[model samples]
Target: MKLYSLMTTAVLIASTSAYYVKNQKSETFSLNVTPVDAGTQEECKTCITFAGQTINDLLQFVLQEEVDVCGDLCQIVVDKTGKEALGVICTILCDVVGIKEFINAIQKADLDPIYFCELVPACPINDNGDAHFTSLEVMPKKGPQGEFDISFEYVSNNGTGTGMLAISVDTVDGIPLGDDFLNFAQPAGTYDGTIKLDAKENPDCDPTQGPCETWEPGTYTIHLSVCNGECGSNHPHSAIYDTKTTTFEITQN
Candidate 1:
């Protein structure tokens, strides 16, 4: 009789504790958006860090001062066609809030969830393999060689950096933006550029943000970083940290 009573008491206590814990806890949520041009494989991952256990909680989190939604925190606007939407999205770990409701909000607003990626070296040209910027030009109206010229000036720490820079522009359908610059497509696309800094320019030393010119029109994100060599280094390579991005419209004549 005594043993039976003890067992029953323990069971009841355990069950009650479990129930209380379940009711008190909330699920954690992570969201990311990567905006890619509709036609090309190129994309830019914009990260908006937020944490909440439930959908209502998550929405409250977004409503917070720190969390950024479309147009307010960041603006991903299509300049020509006046189309605005968010791209590249990763929402992992949803507990309570329905994914449908969350997605609907994003689709209605045309906002893409920002995604995250590993920190890759920005430049591979210099001996240090660090990317440097001296200038950038965005021709909202025209580009070099009839291609939208989103060009930049890269400098090295030793005054020498060499590497190929790839410019990827996203059109709604992979077709290059028009030459005359007048046929701006609606729901216009985004352009993300990645510059490969040559290994020769970096050699052994790292570069710092000395000076760089402003970028061209249209939405833009610029990143500059140093490449840590494959082998673990006994030599300390100082990190390359200097980046700035601004958006402006160009009125073509």
Candidate 2:
């Protein structure tokens, strides 16, 4: 486990019935939360007991009428306390139900943490090597529609673990694109696969429409992110090991 640090500043703000506005005056604070390995109920309880008061204060501040409930409360807490109290709150919350549960709770509350804590297996020690994207090749690179093949490699220098690859596209236009995710069982060596890049392939685009009608001619930015261990789990606990970006052109044909 790695210690997480959160930095924030306090600011005065004016409020109206409709909205809250920020003021110019402010103060800054830094917080560092120590990591704890908790697998049992007693361990979780003990961790929470130590930081109960700070968590209570955070909840109170977040529930205030003038506060932005959807925003990050951890930063606000850090600003208010100007100490490591915010980190303690986060550490306790994460230890209570693991990183996945903690993240789900934060998302459900529409709150953001300063930095997400990665999850490691409860029973086994994780010693997997980091995964990375080695190469990317697009077929018919100038066409309106084609396929992209990406290669990934990892070394089991530490130990054996699972890996995952997540890919997404961003167009010059604001139109939404689709994303693809794949999982790898092997912890070492190389893996490769292809993903279709046709506009009709996009679920958001109507299949009846022709490719030209559905896609705009321009450039698309592709993003690749790879993670090791707990790769297949929803709200995975593994950290992103590598990220790569590349561009493909869609020309009028």
Candidate 3:
């Protein structure tokens, strides 16, 4: 009888705790967005004007003073706002000095419950369209243990700017076979490159012994990324214009 009573008590306590946590998560949160300076506001008027009515109103409200928001309502905000408008707002917000404060306020308010990361843009607004890879192909899709050619076509919306292209080959599980190659000061356009799969490249397998000697006999993905401008080790300013994954297979003899 005493054990039964204890179990009932524990159950009641757990239920109460869950209810409290649920209520806490549903609690309202408030954030104070810093006001934009006159010069900054003037500079961003084009973005604001292009944001349309719904996002414009939200932008105005967020730029003013402290506002109360809840996760449920913020989800609605996201549904109503366009991606481009959010990108503009993020750009403007990041340009401001108090961006960290605003981010902190958002965290404290738990607004992320409604996918806040998706609502905020990470990169600055690019008037030019983003770069993209139109097509990627590997010649001799299945090759004996030897060198292969990879060709890819890319389009840069920012005109013919100099950039860096990084390429690497790895197994499906992400085990790198050879060193990553980087090409700098390359113009934005189609590129044809060569990669070798031999004992020297992998050193783990001996392809001379059989078809799968030097490298594993399976499919591998060639990862390629083109970044704008000279990308250093950190590549902070080097925004990725395009990324592509092309697959090639090594067949057994």
Candidate 4:
């Protein structure tokens, strides 16, 4: 219970910040939202789960203050994941998505419990017809998995250009397990599709070129973000349009 109190205090501190980042309608952050009562761990394995969304919100709120110190934290993520190319994401996520909006979304969790993935671009707040994610689901959410499929709908309200849907599979603590980038001509419409992923798909090293890291039996995070331009590691743009995410467990095969 002490852990919970410490965590809550951190969240309160973040809530009192005077800073305000603009959203779709140029609105400031608001913290009038209350967290849901997350149940026990027996029913929920990961904080990202539907029943555990409150936990996810609390985590994001607590980390909102960390953006100032993310230089060190971001390096740790890059060092562990070896994706030094996209290190800017760590800062972009925190700075772009303020804690005020997190609470606002949490109040509406009855309709949809948005995770961190949803929160980032979701953090961007789609109040102005900005592209946002919906209907995200991971197949066989739990089990001894060698393969899986991620299906979701992305609504783009912008012009047709090189839009990117970046996917990264990582551990709960931020170590990447694998990553994929879906770049396509996105116009004003909603695109829905399911991507097939295998345990053999490695993000660290390319299997086609050499040996790579395979999926292991553990809880992992699948993070997806949408942006207007090329968002590859080498290619960096200013912002992430939106995001969708889920967590799953991989058991022994």
Top model number, TM-score:
2
Please name the candidate that would achieve the greatest lDDT relative to the true structure.
4
lDDT of 2 by residue, 1-253 (tens): 3223222232111111111111111121111112232343222223223232244455455346343322254455566667554455555555656545544454432221111222211122234555555666565566654434333333333432333445556766565443322132233445444444444234553446533234567877777665553333344335566777777787775
**Per-residue CA lDDT of candidate 4, range 37-101, in tens?**
23321111121222122333334444574433545544544555465533444444434555455
Full ranking by lDDT: 4, 2, 3, 1
Give the per-residue lDDT digits (tens) of candidate 1, residues 50-83. 1111223333334554532433322222222132
Q: How many pairs of residues in model 3 come into backbone collision?
A: 5
The stretch of ten residues in a row with the least summed lDDT in candidate 1 is: 1-10
Ranked by TM-score, top first = 2, 4, 3, 1
State model 1's lDDT: 0.23
What is the TM-score of candidate 2?
0.41
- For model 3, the stretches where C-alpha displacement exceeds 4 angstroms are 1-130, 172-174, 178-213, 230-236
Q: Which has the higher lDDT value, candidate number 3 or candidate number 4?
A: 4
Per-model lDDT:
0.23, 0.40, 0.39, 0.42
RMSD of each: 24.8, 17.2, 21.5, 19.2
lDDT of 3 by residue, 145-181 (tens): 5656565566654542323445556764444432322
Q: After superposition, how far is residue 9 of candidate 4 from its true place, in Å?
A: 47
lDDT of candidate 3? 0.39
Each candidate structure's TM-score, on Cα atoms with residue i matched to residue i, is: 0.20, 0.41, 0.37, 0.41
